[model samples]
Target: MRRGLKITLVAVTGAALTLSASACGGKKADSDDGGGGDKKSLKIGLAFDIGGRGDQSFNDSAAAGLDRAKKNLNVQTEEISAKPDEPDADKESRLRLMANKGYNPVIGVGFAYTTAIIKVAKDFPNTKFLVVDADQCKVEGANVSGACFSEEQGSYLVGAAAALKSKSGTIGFIGGVNVPLIQKFFAGYQAGAKAAKPGIKVLPPKYLTQPPNFNGFKDTGLGNEAAKGQLDQDADVIYHAAGGAGIGVIKTVGQAGKWAIGVDSDQYNQPAVAGVKQQILTSMVKHVDLAVYDFVESVANNTFKAGTKQYDLKNDGVGYAPSGGNVDDIKARLEELKAKIVSGEIQVPTKV
Candidate 1:
């Protein structure tokens, strides 16, 4: 089984129920109770990226928001995951299925859904569609919203931390895919590392895979190999934007008694990687949870609107995680750089 397309209905109380019967193509079902009849009856649908909820990174961060919304906002939710080799048509079908089943505020959790969202949002004019990490749906649609983040801004902070903490002057960067988005991480990281330590040696950026080869986002074997290669070159600290693949990178770094920087979520707090928690210097915390929660809350409060919503360092949408207290000594310096970035004094590059 792919374990990707499983439709799980999350009850308001945080328990997940497998829906044996679905309305559209045997994949999803709407909750009947509607939050114990006290709160607004809203059905929110989420389509996750390749790694799904257990990735302990990107998808898990989005799940955090959905779970929080269910508990605090009293809403029902249906969640589905994307297959590894899923095509654009499959993504469109997933979103269409959610909208057809009366799931309002259908949210797509990755940039891969940009095309699907643009296509599906047109058919269902009533249901709101939100796309995270992408701004493709920010056009003239009344029911579409793009939740975009300045990932480079947060990556810069962690890069500075990596430079400050590295015992060996050389640090490495591991990116999931060779796409512009991942490159943005590289650009900021390189800039921040150099800015923090003028002579810091940032090894050439290495990506697990390129476009059309998205396995980089979920391939632990590749992540391990990449991290090991950098370590062999005497790199003491490593930062990764490789989604679930980052687990392998972190593990390898930890076992070698080296520092690692996590991405998307606070990997230090993740139980899945508890053994390596001590090695995680800090994480580039992109608040996908906050964005997802805000969108759900907007729909519930009848304040939903279309267009682009930016979450950047200035607005606390992106930040560095204070994990393991590894960066405590350099906290003041990091904050100074952050303030400069926010004030436009330090321009974080989005391209390598």
Candidate 2:
């Protein structure tokens, strides 16, 4: 059930929840270009997953970071969506379109573009290729830089916090896919819950087998239905690592008067479901923006490197969200867990 890290969907969180509940990984290279070895200008292309611009997660975070790159680095950028419905579709048409249109470095956000990238990169050797969450992705003609994160460590701390703060002994998690990456989130969350309070029960309403499959993530009705189901089982706090799917869970929790935990980018700040502004206890931050920003900067400076990369709590790449809604009450305990995780006192287990 731990294939969550598959390149076709929500890559990181899908894979990490298995050891207790299992695992997840990305790549890039640089070419020397005369003065200081950095490119004067780069044409960047981004293809987002189906949830599109309204997702407020995953694709949104990637776009936010890339936007920062455009503003700060003066790079040209463009983006398109994969229609989430057909993750495995040969976006070669889109990738080819970008290449033909003069976008130098083409990027594929989720793992869904793995095979497509392998094909497109081969066809466009001169154009650099990038895939987030697909470390093993390689294209012969293009240099593929996969951006990955250590979601387990981040989720563990948040999970631990959830367990510690739960009035009821039950905590919950929802995944976008049931692959290793998403599974890691569940596994780490469970471990953290158990660590926080021995014998704590973690309820998983659903597991996603398809990468980027927001069928469940997209429907507020389903997200709510699933969350309500967990609550019905007596779960007090629900943690959703389902990307846009988590947004639905957050909204449902708000309506149901329960606590919800956000993931990836903080959903508490968005206006989609502001009514439950106070319902979000905290978020499991992946700093996807940081990754995007770094990749763009690296390309500009000609310092890009290849091979899989990991962003964990230690590197300040991932962490719990900032207090926004009604987090004041839990800030003290949250801070305590933060200290332990960052200080290495608490090794938020990445593999069970």
Error of 2 at 105 (Å): 1.3
Compose the digit string of candidate 2's lDDT tens values, residues 124-150.
Answer: 767777777773333333366777777
- Tell me, by TM-score, which candidate is best: 1
Clash pairs, model 1 backbone:
none
- Those runs of model 2 whose alpha carbons end farther than 4 Å from true positions after fitting are 1-40, 135-142, 208-214, 325-346, 350-352
lDDT (Cα, 0-100) at 18 in candidate 1: 37
Assess the local accuracy of residue 81 in candidate 1 as a C-alpha lDDT between 0 and 100. Answer: 79
Collision count for each candidate, in order: 0, 48
Clashes of 1: 0
Model 1 residue runs over 4 Å out of place are 1-39, 135-140
